[model samples]
Target chain A: MTGLPEPLRSRLHPLDRTLDTLETPAVLIDADVADANLVRWQQRCDRAGVANRPHIKTHRSVAWALRQLELGAEGITVQTVGEAEIMADAGISDIFLTTNVLGEAKLARLGAVASRCSLSVVADSAEIVDAAAAAARAAGATITVLVECDTGGGRCGLADPAAIAALALRIAGSEGAKFGGLMTYPGAGKRLQTEQALQAAIAACRGTGLTVPAVSSGGSPDMWKDDGLEPLTEYRAGTYIYNDRALLSRGTATLDQCAMTVLATVVSRPTAGRAIIDAGSKALTSDLLGLDGYGLVLEHPDAVIYQLNEEHGLLDVSRCSAPPSVGDRVHVLPNHTCVVTNLFDRLFIVSGGRLQGALPVEARGRSI
Target chain B: MTGLPEPLRSRLHPLDRTLDTLETPAVLIDADVADANLVRWQQRCDRAGVANRPHIKTHRSVAWALRQLELGAEGITVQTVGEAEIMADAGISDIFLTTNVLGEAKLARLGAVASRCSLSVVADSAEIVDAAAAAARAAGATITVLVECDTGGGRCGLADPAAIAALALRIAGSEGAKFGGLMTYPGAGKRLQTEQALQAAIAACRGTGLTVPAVSSGGSPDMWKDDGLEPLTEYRAGTYIYNDRALLSRGTATLDQCAMTVLATVVSRPTAGRAIIDAGSKALTSDLLGLDGYGLVLEHPDAVIYQLNEEHGLLDVSRCSAPPSVGDRVHVLPNHTCVVTNLFDRLFIVSGGRLQGALPVEARGRSI
Candidate 1:
């Protein structure tokens, strides 16, 4: 990339600009790498005879979701009603709402989404089942309810298999709800415990005369560990589309497989041992994921991103043999890719090191 | 607030819906409390006889910025050219960009901002000054350059007074650039060191026959500690508009003074000792700021927000005598306020315990 002024340089390269020519603090999604990841994950799911329901929270782009569907994903998993609404409006017919919708205001929106598309939601309690059924009935929609099981995630789900079966029965008995299946966001490195929990929940549901059609369990850390022999019919993995530093550290993916990267410029060389990048917590996000630093500078492997402020990433380049200079552009692989998508409204798409058009993260900040 | 269904409840209150009626994972800014905070801080700055350049990073709203100016703010401090451009387009004439924009593409945008408003930027290196000066000259705009001093803020800025003085001289000698002043984001609890560094830089500038017009220093943690006795012409303070848990922990703000609160609903109660909220790192953000938990639940003070996923906030409520139930609404005072504004596209403006309207965070992700 020529270092000429922006307008002149853009005129010089009319078709596509390189990564360095793009604006700093920009999010780059290597389209080739992302497509390869999509195909690879789809092949694995296809081989296992299990449904691959890709989670849309990673990219949050309707275009990317469509691309995933084009690659043969069964249905997309949305964590919120807002995302479901967006995907449904975009003509995505099938969606699985992973998060439990309880509040009447939010459930009504979910009901509206269900009316627009084939929507299914998760519930861990009878209260949520009743509320969702009421909302669905009011909206004249049929909502499938997946009983969420606590498969060691410990966040939101019933740990007791009896409770899970009871919730499934309640949903089937409800006015506008249908008992669909079981879903569990398994904790990392707890595949055995997760399988046991799911097996117990399935058995309890069968005992209650309820047929659990689909059992879904997924997490990025355990993406490749699932042998499909577990009591699961579908898998939901979000971070596989754009693996991050955490996934790289786990050996789940390599640097070549990381689709998303934060392009930042060295704005300040404060000292010989210290350099400041324009991308900070606002751009890269403050998700450590048990890592020591916010992210890894792909160009300078020895340089450590030791600290981060709202708009400044402080790099401890003391150990680096050749530190970066001001205006030098660098790519950062964030610790968590999901939060990084939430941080930006749009991401710059790149392929073969050439800049492509920017895609808006339509589901960004759509937590509700 | 009423457990009565949504349509009935909304029809009951035709105009004003309470906080309970708002959607979960919503960011509510108490207008009254925010105005009180504005007035109180303005009064303090007024008494000190210093220019109050309130940083717009906290609210990222043009309406709030105009209100601050109406309440006698000298100017608004922006951290990026994108923010400056948004404020300048909104007719805010004076903007001080606290970040160092160095790259050609970004510097050109900063030049455009300079052409539109009274723009000033901080720089700690001659490379930045030279690049900014070239961009300014090319754009036919005059940009003010402030020599950034380390001043105990270990992130950016030069530590050596001689180097700062030399950079200031370069700014003064460069075309389309004027040496404005000395600026530093003083480290928390290092006021003396900051003052000494600033005093030395000031003296060095004087030695070089460069009379610093403005000696600006500011930080939220050190907001009240500045007695205006230190050599300074202006102070930049963000995060004071809506003091957060960090300030609350520092004894700088009380519970009644925090204007911003994340209104989330208890979605699930998987166990007797645990309840999950809809707001997580996405809505509330992951900025711990050395805090123990993600945030403080206002209603349930004993409830600890122990874990945060992208959309789930796990609360350890064993210590609480009265645990929350599903669909129960809760307000979370985040560990940091600045990052919350960046996470949302709009904020709910609440006044008199009623939801007034939603204000767009126009400069939310405007980081170049």
Candidate 2:
């Protein structure tokens, strides 16, 4: 009686109350699993002598961000200026924006947010560094700039060590900008190349009389396989807090360890093999992340969500002898729960099978 | 001159202001194109003598729904109870809920909203019909119930015409429910089967001495090619407002007719053939809808958005003769514009390439 757990005998408990009282298509954050996840990651980083700066995009709740801070996280990492502003408003002092800040409007916003908090951003190009420096000077604030190295990731970053060092030197030379360190997503399965690139970039920066104080590396898929560890001052990961199927499929996190689960009700059983649930692409989201189905049905492991409309999840239950009927509730572990957080307004918090309350997902869809 | 277009020559216009002043990763709705779409669809439905009940889920906007009503839309269609409540709250007199109402909480909500507006719902199961009737009776409201038919759509619906008529007869007999008509999504490329099912259902209902007033059909993919209109009293279409790449790929819509364009900035041109934009799965969404890439970059038709992280859209520009550089903006036609509406809080409205204002996507992510 797990995954889509059977209704508890005790109706007074919060979990049963949630299942019984709340409408379908609700996001439930199991506090026990989430708290354990937070503690486990923080301890791992502490053991490695590295600062754990959790990315807020996964949970996107100020309450969880504060909880991570209480667990002794060094700071917080944000991908957009809107996230930094929101987290800063909630008194999160140290913020690191991982995306390259481009354009005049965004640069001006970056400077404003920097003035409000101890802010640092990544830069892979000299033009970005110059623009940030200019914006910082105009706002009467000094910005800490990190050189983003491509390492093995095919996304944004300078692939060449010399270019990373040169960009670091350029930032260090700017009066309004201070060269902070190096940052990279470090494409998974290319550890040797990722480490080598960072080490070489550090030596190149040192050759130019630029001191590297902090080096950040991240990517949840390869976070736990720390064989020897890279030359990292800190590690940033968002999905560690509420593991999804992407982590589960990789054997990184077990089924019981996943904190967030989507609770949906079977709206129709059109055929013997098909059961349509209230949760759809808008609720669970369509981020497959290289998985087979949309999410994992806890009650029936054989069930596969073959398709989704805007408000319906089509589950092929042909293989399951005991399938969910109309009005039967099923708990689903979303393939990628990060996108799920941004899909809803609030998440139901459950502890000890009792509904504690709900926390608003305030930073959701803050794509500006 | 087109997508990801170069800055407009006239900066004083609202469209130019939106292009130059607004931040990247913004959703822009072209009024001229959108208005043309609305009028064209409305006129088509008028000529067919079918009521044009536009689905609000496409835009998830109250302003747009009101505009549609002003343009002679029979009534607005909603997929979820939350959408119905919101539209009803906006003084919308009539609302049709397409999804089946299951469970006590949602049924109670349905009855409450029915009390507020001329509310109707679709039901394929006897249990849903009974539960909704009981809820309506308790709330002192009569919910107009439409029998949902499968009609080749493998999702939620009663496939057999006799079963559809049985459900309609049951609703007609219920004191708290009224037999409104029949409804089906009518899965694309199955017109003959869809019409046959509807005609049979209507005959079965007539044999049962139940009057069928409305026979509603909807599906945006094959909407334009009406070989011969079905026996429908009303038609529903959502994506026709802001045509997307999915419609464009199928030749249902042309590139020039796409109204909703994601305006994103090129944050990094990491290599000669790769550029990263600020818009990712969160901004543009990952709904391929049988399309090739994430979106169609208007400026570089050959460029492909191969992959997406949370905040980065990776572009493969090796085949493009003139690729966009850093700080350059790109107007992207999303793979599916419906999901994109749910990803933003406010969509910027553009007229004559100028920023008219913004409409709150108030009904977005209302999967309740």
Candidate 3:
């Protein structure tokens, strides 16, 4: 073949205009709704006499994290050291990494970020504490360590309260480590058990003559019940800002309160009862948190995205009396907002049914 | 606090070095195995007297697409106009966009792409054909249109063979449009039915005095049985390049032939039978595809990743005779490799247990 012509640049119409002109398969975040959610959570935490530390993993935008901090959040919580690094580079001074930082290489990376920011991390074992301590010493940084206590969550954490205290004490005795407190991501709807577990861990720490600086417990499902847990000095929640179908199913937030949505266009209607959309597992995500479908279709409430390929959403329109036609736009509230945020590199900030600006997902794909 | 020291630059070590020093949650592709898969598939298609057009949606890497073309692939197939744009920019001449292009904006974008490359698309409806025709005429381009016939996939496609032929005739008669052929993504284990469906559609096209230039049928599960279908002159398969666990479960491929694996690290051991890895839904993807778990632990054959959060994979090691420890590196074979490729920004190309280079997933996040 001869020399080819100049290839056209496929640019998705910018969100600088109205939402009607924006492209499909785009992540649209209602900034007003997000701000309202932020203020509501802040006021709730203030009433409960607790600190509000929103997890940055939900949005992963430095701009949004700054907004949360401006809205009276004490600090930010990150899931990965990579996220902490990104936030610290953006001049954030306080960050709490909720995941356990193990391995010498990772702890060293964590120590580098902790040196610049008042960083605290959760550890469930003695090996993790020792690694963090050594890394902090090498960096000449004082690292705060929170012993992760597993109340009912079957994920990572120390189940024994005494073990948590022992780990905290180990942090206190280490060269460059300070015992911050206890932190637990409680199981869904296990508020009472989480409170009891944190209380026992705090008592065990007190018995060792170590004052726990902050006792943290978090889960969006039980965010409103923070006042019932007397020992928790702080609450960290990521999904509350961009509520999803999972939270909606739990009645934690109303559908109107959901801030994030996926804007998709009906590309094809193969059958009378089936419509294919531009968004699929890549755009909407495949996180089925015990919900009926992948997401909630806003335009056609009864329609279900029963299946998804990598690029096409299989919309089951059997339940919809009047289903969407090809070329119609639709909004999909994903089942889990956190995963959806990480799936896209940019999100369109929309408010009042108009486009604001695009926010880059700075910490997206920072899994390490 | 006093003025903090200079923040260390956070760098997830690049794949320029060996694979042994690579980071976790990294998508690693064995170049040798991938090239072998390319040659094997090409040879299989040649033996069956058909053209091989592997879908670039699997890897979404322009470099790999070029390599496939270099290995005797007739052309490449993409799932989106965004993908077609990227492939054309990389000097790829022939591209078959498998999804229907609808709406004025998308049709305009599709026409722009068609102007610079030999672009072909599949359509199941007359509206799609009319849109393509109008867009091509405006762009001064001749676009090839393929009628998509639904055999049993129940996704996007016309179920009626006569309807497919009618759409083909419309394309043949439309301004700046050419009737390319018929296309169908056969359902898993439904190759015979897909063949019958395509044969009927081709017959209908002939009855309408329109010659179907190319009859295409594809699916990774039924790729080996393509020779059984006599009417097909072209075959498209994507997942065959990077065989996933779902394909392995379907008995389409063995574990050794799987070219793609998510390299993760054991970050925590919460219980004796549970090890939490750094790779979660964001890294490994939660596409179960009706499998036992999220993915297969390649190191620990009996261990199952029973649960996953956005950033943590819960490993159930009860069935394993020997389990991995915290900080141990493990390779996970994702259930669906295509989605896994879209989740990451770059992939480490490994061969002979050493990192060769980094392949950018250029077409990733191009769902629009």
Please, what is the TM-score per model?
A: 0.95, 0.95, 0.95
For A177-284, candidate 1 gives per-residue lDDT tens digits of 999989999888888899999999999999999899899887888889755347889999999999999999999999999998999999888888999999998998
For lDDT, candidate 2 versus 3, the one ahead is 2
lDDT scores in order = 0.86, 0.86, 0.85
- 1 or 3: which has the higher lDDT? 1
lDDT of 3 at A165: 79
Predicted structure 3: clash tally: 0
Model 2, docking class? medium
Q: Estimate, for each residue in A2-27, the C-alpha lDDT of model 2 and write its tens digit.
A: 32211111211333345477888999
Interface RMSD of each: 1.0, 1.0, 1.6
Proportion of native contacts in model 3? 0.68
Model 2 spans with C-alpha error above 4 angstroms: A1-17, B1-17
* Candidate 3 wrongly placed segments (more than 4 Å): A1-17, B1-17
DockQ of each: 0.73, 0.73, 0.55
> Fraction of true contacts kept, per model?
0.82, 0.75, 0.68
